[model samples]
Target: MKKKFKILIADRNPHVREFLRREMAGPGYRVRLAENGREVLKFIYGDEFVDLLILDPDLPDTDAPALLRKLQNRLPYIPVVLHTFIADLGHCPDIFNVVAVVEKGGSSVERLKTVVYEILAKDRAKEKIRNNMQSAGQKKAAPATGGKDEQK
Candidate 1:
């Protein structure tokens, strides 16, 4: 069976978290909600893998720079989407894995969904290409039989 994409949505507001959870989960994504920076760390560092992260920089107890630095050091491949107000955008750190930033608004949920889809789709394409290259390398590297009749 194909694996369902796992998304971690980190936000300070309960309503926003629940809203995003319902929206993302409706389309068959495995959604996990984090109300604070601690929960976000827990979910990311735990056993299960997360394919994408939708994060609000205003998460309590930890600042965006610190959290982003940790994420970059540990799991650089896991893409992050910053969902924040327009004012907070200027304060966002220039991190490697943060693929996009969506402004918080009434209609931002749809934009967030679209960004998530695009990032995950690109990830899937890269994975497919890597798998193909690996298989091709393996085929090329296979040991050849040593016999006089064997073609060169």
Candidate 2:
């Protein structure tokens, strides 16, 4: 059986969180919610692995840029989709790691859905390549002694 990808949605508004959680929930993805930066951090540090993050830059507890930096430090490989009112993130170099910057406006939810699908597709491609490389490595390492006793 295939495992579902886990996504963390971090927004200050409960409605927004619920909306996203509902939107992102489906057969291929598992959605998690966080109302603030602290909860987001806790979720990240938890045992459950997160595959993606949908973050709102207007978080009440902490600066979004700082949170992005912290997330990068902790889980650099996880892709982030920054959903915010402020679309001009060109000044924030730290947010360069974000795979998508979605403006919070009419039709934004649809846009977010599209971007999530695109990002998850890319992630799956990368995972496949990584797994192939690992399997190849294991195959090469398996014959260290030729699986037989040395010649007499």
Candidate 3:
């Protein structure tokens, strides 16, 4: 069986959260919603293993960049897709874990899903390589306990 990816959508608007949850909660994905940056932080800091984060930069109670920085410091492996009104993220600094910046609007939902799929696919590829390497290492490390060499 294929592993399902877990995505966390962090936005202040309930509508946005619901829309994202609905859009991303299909096959091969498990979506989690958070209404604020605080909630996002709570989910990230907790024991739950989130594969990706779709974050709104205009979050209440916490600056998005700060939160992103903190998240990068703690969990750099997880990729982030910044879904916001900010069309251009060129000037923004400290973009460590951000994989894509998607502007919110009419067709942004579809764009978000595409980006999510691509990022998750890349992650899956990496995981496969890692697992294969581990399996190869184990095979090499296995001892020939009862082989012809044991009688020599």
Off by over 4 Å in 1: 26-28, 94-96, 144-152
Candidate 2, residue 21: CA error in Å? 0.9
CA lDDT, every prediction? 0.88, 0.86, 0.87
User: What total of clashing residue pairs does each candidate reach?
Assistant: 0, 0, 0
Stretches > 4 Å off in candidate 3: 87-92
Tens-place lDDT per residue, model 2, 35-140, is 9989988976778879999988777788778888888888889999988877445545578469888999888999999999999988888888999999999998
lDDT of 1 by residue, 1-152 (tens): 54589999999999999999999995547999899999988866788778999999988898888899888888889999999996876666565678898999999999999999999888888988998999999999997789787986
lDDT of 3 by residue, 1-152 (tens): 89999999998899889988999999999999888888888877899979999988777888667888889888989999988887535434667798898999999999999999999999899999999999999999998698776875
Please give the range of 10 consecutive residues that has the lowest summed lDDT in model 3.
Answer: 87-96
lDDT of 3 at 142: 92
